[model samples]
Target: MSQQRIETIQKWLKDQNAEFAFIQSKANLFYLTGFRCEPHERLISLFVFQDKEPFLVCPNMEKPLISQAGWAYPIIGYSDHENPWELINKYLSTYSFEQNIAAIEKEALSVARHEQLQNLFPTFTFVNCEQGIMEMRLIKNEDEIAILREAAKLADFGVEVGINAVKKGRTEMEILALIEYELKKKGIAEMSFGTLVLSGENTANPHGHPNTKQIKEGDFVLFDLGVVVEGYCSDITRTIILGQPTEQQEQIYSTVLKAQEETLHICREGTILGDLDRKARSIISNAGYGEYFPHRIGHGLGSEVHELPSLNETNNDRLQVGMTFTIEPGIYLPGVGGVRIEDDVLITKQGHECLTKFPKELQIIHS
Candidate 1:
């Protein structure tokens, strides 16, 4: 499985005119090597070339695990206190890559590491490879899509548990506990983000953390959570009303749902992101909730909760088939509550496919 990904990366490196590329980002490393490692002050980096086999440089303690993964690459281990620059320089010299241009992940490479590399090999040239690699990962392959689908299914089940657990006197923290418990029950080891269970006026905060405030009758209940399954992530949000919703709340909920549905309808391959965002924002704005809708419509999702090809009015990138992202639109009223409905979407040649199958209609749960 990893061999195919390595071959694909090699082809991409050749096309980009890169002599060699270094990958240090934890998520990218997992994608390329199928070996997961915790990120720490001690860096574990991988080097790949167009024709040669990939090589990994890490602390001595990690060699056993790396070897157990059955990677067909050379593993170079160094002492914990030893300078990694010395080992890297020796390896490069042995490979006869002196003075060659090397592509480095500027986003992940620290200034300290950069300085060490420069000092070790003053003749070598370093180029920023972050964008090149990110572009390659933007589109999801078949395996990646399958994992994301499973993640979405698990997230839907978690949402169902959270909604049912909502009560008039339950605290926001209790609701979050129920959501996480349900996620764990479905075999989700880690969440894409912390569970957000906001009630009443606290729902107005888009990224607010759950607190101990008890939910009141006739208050809005917001849930934004996701789970990581097989390295891919699934993110979704659903808002419900406790008891009965007022006329204004009902109107706001309807407007947000309409915006989400319209956006999904127009999102497809070859569509401009800016236009897609406008289609959703225009619906809310036309409904007289322009100021309430402040954030972007959505963002790309994959190994990371947020990746590239953001969906917003400012983004002009054209949508391509196999791209996956979220479509979340909300309205926040200060001193009141907010309503946000989000789902995972995948772009296809024919049109857009909604991966999240949760009900979008506002649920009125009597306390």
Candidate 2:
């Protein structure tokens, strides 16, 4: 377990005048306790007190796994037949704290679960703790950066496999399957999100799904995928062309490449996060494809693929040393195709490092 991270949360709880924090999200639980579990439809939470030792509650069957995961704290495991909340209340009875205030992740807790928590401690006032957690997670440590670097390399390998699988008459699903098959062979058990491999006009949809649409000559294929490595995630997007591209396609591809590369160049410790989005937007707008470019430049990348410090034109958060995110620019024209070039980026004191090192140059796949 990361005593340091747990202490950080405890500090936040103390500062907020909260007696404790109920962390329910799996990502946040893993972040604080160094134990990761899927606990599907089950209760798994971490209760951290401001001045007392914290304990974890999870399904009884997973108790051994939690110990194996290096959690040296008290664990309150409950069987499937018991109400976990009752167990939690029984456990909390052992410790005495101000039953007046508590911190909870407002974004993650469901309304039903919120009611349960309320029923358990009707006198406790719950305040939002998600922002504090997000702020703490914004800056990447040396170890996180190192793991992200490895994850990014695996992401690059995913793109390479997708590129090699691209051929004439191949369906989008066919290529998608091949890429995942290769990644499985490489020991990747999970992807950051649903793997995206869109070909031809389907690429115009930013979040399109892979299907039976077959690739043909003069089609643009976009590979947007990521992999999980040691609990960290790496996201990368690269669009390539099959056969010779028309002048319009070339223009679209080059504009996206320029916008993405130029944005990456300005990443540093003091850079404004939103300006990166505006910089890329301005380029795409100046190139007469502003309407074609939708969505934010990128989002935060870490243990969870989409997290804090959203990179958009409105966010005013400043980039800091050890911050990591993605810089992607794209142009989608309906009925034609789309082009997106993305890279995982890290902000350092000197400058920035692009983690995904795959080529940004427009790759033309002849035949």
Candidate 3:
């Protein structure tokens, strides 16, 4: 972890008056310790507190890999079969932190793990630390932004391939398969979410999954996908007409594009996120498509696909520089297909930078 990050954690611990914080989420663990270990039903955890170096606990089998990650902390490895709670408790008992409040990741900690920890440390109070950690990571740093930029670039390349794959006689599943293949070819090992390849009336579903229905002429095709790079994520969506678009299809597409463009122009640091959502939604609403635009304008993107500072009417979190998220607005009409345009954007000092630079103009693919 960087010195600045460590200092930030220390300040947060001080403000919260916490003796130590136990982080078990794989993504959070990687963010703090710079060690990328799978949290696969195992008790790989990290403990950090004030005036003390952080400590990592993992199975002995993972020691070599953990060591290579260059974590500036003590790595305590126990046998896979040994009771990890017992080992952790023994270490805790030796310290003077008895009866002190220890913050634990409430959201990510499984019930079984929480019960085990409670039983082991009956004297210490365990409090929720998930929100505290999330607050810390909501804003991106320089290194995180760089990773997100690269992830967006990779998604752009994959989108081009996916758009080209849409053709007459091709199934939605086949188009998705092609996108996945291109993502892998571009070295993206993980997808932020399942690839959504919706066609025709299916496009009315915002979260539609790829199906076996074959593509045909004059059908609307929507591609919503993202790629994960070094634990950071990027999301982008584009809608295309398989053949020539009908008059109504063209109208809906133009309205959606105008809304997205206007919202993008107004996005900047300190702007109320909900205001951005409303700006785009008002356009669709005035055009009599408000009911079709059901979901929020966008969401924060980072280690986990969805983070803090949601772009919605209910959220009042002000945008800050270094924050990266998506700006997606759509108009979905049931039985009439839908049109959506989305892009990954980085909040900058002046305005916002569009990371997903792939063409958003409606493309007409011929047979």
lDDT of each: 0.87, 0.91, 0.85
83-159: candidate 1 lDDT, tens digit per residue: 77688888778675533677888888888888877786577788887777678789999989999999998888888
Per-model root-mean-square deviation over C-alphas: 1.9, 1.0, 1.7
Top-lDDT structure, candidate number: 2
lDDT of 3 at 247: 89
TM-score of 3: 0.95
- Cα lDDT of model 1 overall? 0.87
| Local distance difference test, candidate 3 | 0.85
* TM-score of candidate 2 to 2 decimals: 0.98
Weakest lDDT window of 10 consecutive positions for candidate 3: 91-100
After best superposition, candidate 2 residue 347: deviation in angstroms? 0.5
For each candidate in turn, the TM-score is: 0.94, 0.98, 0.95
Once model 3 is optimally superposed onto the true structure by TM-score, how far is the C-alpha of residue 141 displaced, in angstroms? 2.4
- Predicted candidate 2 versus true structure: per-residue lDDT over 1-367, tens digit per residue: 3799999998998899998899989889889888887888998999899888889999989999888878899999999899999988887777766558989999999898889989988888899999999999999999999999999999999999999888999999999999899999999999999999999999999999889999999999999999998888999999999999999999999999889888988898888888999999999999999999999999998989999879999989799988889998999999999998889999988899999999989899976
Q: Write the number of the candidate with greater TM-score, choosing between 1 and 2.
A: 2
> Which ranges in model 1 have alpha carbons more than 4 Å from their true place?
15-17, 68-70
